[model samples]
Target chain A: MARVVVDVMPKPEILDPQGKAVLGALPRLGFSGVTDVRQGKRFELEIEGELTDDVVEQVRQMAETLLSNPVIEDFEVHVEEHSVAEVAASEGR
Target chain B: MARVVVDVMPKPEILDPQGKAVLGALPRLGFSGVTDVRQGKRFELEIEGELTDDVVEQVRQMAETLLSNPVIEDFEVHVEEHSVAEVAASEGR
Candidate 1:
């Protein structure tokens, strides 16, 4: 199996209240050196077979269509090759 | 400058209400092939210097200390080497 990773984030021009909340909480949480924080979303998927470019494109379409708000958010997809042994080792019972 | 990416997610055993909420919203948003969706947080840092192993470790500690709830969330940090040309090309006006 292959590992597919998706990262979704609000467009730079958009106001991300969730990120703002996290940024506001950082200093109180004891992070001093941090001057700014922008929050986004991540998704990891274990596809059932080898990762091909076509599959990656399909997932990207899915992300654009339903996983993210294209009007305010953008996303990136990363596909990594994983051997069956690695997949089995990573799997949880 | 180097780009430091941090991904934070709730521990497998912890309840992630936000992820659940997003998963619930997917179907309504027209994502049919998706059977499951897990949501996490991402942070992109544009550090002011070359990314050394020491800086990566320091950022990891910061994530553990203030960016994530150690009791419930786990995080991964990825530091990519970015050349000045690539960095300049990627910069937005």
Candidate 2:
């Protein structure tokens, strides 16, 4: 199976209140030197086939259509061919 | 600068309606082997100065407070150095 990871983020110019709130909270959490924080979204998909150009395209389209907000957000899609368990196992080694 | 990446995911027991919707739409987008899609969130922060344990802990707390829904989500945090521009340039090579 192919695994796909999608990351979506607000445009840099846009104000991200959530991110700002996190930034504001960092000092109280015991982090003194922290200056900024930005928040975004991630999606992981397991597809039942080999990783191919067509599959990548479809995944990208999927991100554009339903995974991201075109107005204020930007997105990126990454595809790989391994299950999460397999990935964890390989990393454990 | 230290770069912090936070990935937040729904607890396996929680229902991800948006993720389900994305999974349902994948087939129409032309990905055939796609079986499941789990959507989550990613937060990238550019912190000023060196990366230290305290900084990492602070970033994690920030994630918990503002970036994720505590009841339904689980999270992981990663810290690195280098600006986004530098990271992009290194990847371009």
Candidate 3:
């Protein structure tokens, strides 16, 4: 099966209270130096077969139509690794 | 200045109703071939200085204590490119 990851975030002009909340809480928690924060959404989609450009385009359409709100957000599709387990085990990112 | 990205996702064993809702709606929209879906959080952190290992560690702590709920989620620290503007411009992911 193929796995595609979609990352969605607010547009540059939008205000993200959730992110702001986190930013405000950072210094209080003893974590400083973070100047700003923008919170977003991550979607991991599992496909039944090989990943192709067609699948990417279809997923892009999904992002445009549903995964993100075009009026305020932006999204990007990434061919994710096998799973988060593997990602945590390797790359460590 | 530096930018770091923190991605938080529900644990594999956890129930993701939001993801399920999206999955259920996918086929109705005629976008098939997607077998499963998992929704997560992505945080873009803009820092005030150069990217150092210590900075990465600090952000990891932020992900643990603020950006994510460690009990039910897993988070990763990634050195993000300058900005989402750049991601949207190049790589396209």
Candidate 4:
């Protein structure tokens, strides 16, 4: 199956409390140099066939209508050659 | 400031109810061809300087220790040349 990725991130003006919490917690955990943080969502979709343009368009529409909130967020979509597990394994994790 | 991206995904064996909910909701929204769906997280970190190896290493460590639950999730890190807003603008959105 082909894998498609959709990333939904809050608008630049939107406040991300989750990311803020991480930013605050990081310095306490001995990590530094991170000036800001924004948390978002990622979706991986497994499809039955090749990544045809028609299929990609369908996914994009899905992302626009259901996967993201246009008023407060934006999303990007692309196809991946491997699944998340495959990528992790290839890195020798 | 340079940006770093961390993508944290649940282990393949773990049950992802969020993704399952999306999968069920898709067909109802008139989108199809998706056989499966997995939901994950994306974090964007804005740093003060260039993306040096030392800084990248720090972000990776942060991902491991705080951004994700190691027992249930796996994360990948990389440097992004632009923030999500820039990318969207370039796409003429």
Candidate number of the best lDDT: 4
Give the distance in Å from residue B29's predicted Cα in candidate 2 to where it truly belongs.
5.1
Every model's TM-score: 0.69, 0.76, 0.92, 0.95
Clashing pairs in 4: none
lDDT of 4 at B90: 86
Better of 1 and 3 by lDDT: 3
**Candidate number that wins on TM-score, 3 or 4:** 4
Better of 1 and 2 by lDDT: 2
- Locate the minimum summed-lDDT window of 10 residues in model 2 chain A: A84-93
Would you list the clashing residue pairs of candidate 3? none
The best-first sequence of candidates by TM-score reads: 4, 3, 2, 1
- Which regions of candidate 3 deviate over 4 angstroms? A89-93, B89-93
Any idea what lDDT model 1 has? 0.64
lDDT of 4 by residue, A1-67 (tens): 7899999999999999998999999889998788999999999999998889999999989988999
| Tens-digit lDDT string for candidate 2 (B1-93) | 767888788776778898898777766766567788887777788878777787777777776776677777777776645433343346451
Pick the DockQ winner.
4
lDDT for each candidate structure: 0.64, 0.71, 0.86, 0.89
lDDT by residue (A5-88, candidate 2, tens digit) is: 877887777898988887787666655666677777888887776788888887777777778876777777765454333433
Per prediction, the TM-score for chain B is 0.76, 0.81, 0.89, 0.92
Each prediction's fraction of true contacts recovered: 0.26, 0.63, 0.69, 0.76
Q: Judged by lDDT against the true structure, how good is candidate 3?
A: 0.86
**Full candidate order by lDDT, most accurate first:** 4, 3, 2, 1
Residue pairs with backbone overlap in model 2: A48-B33
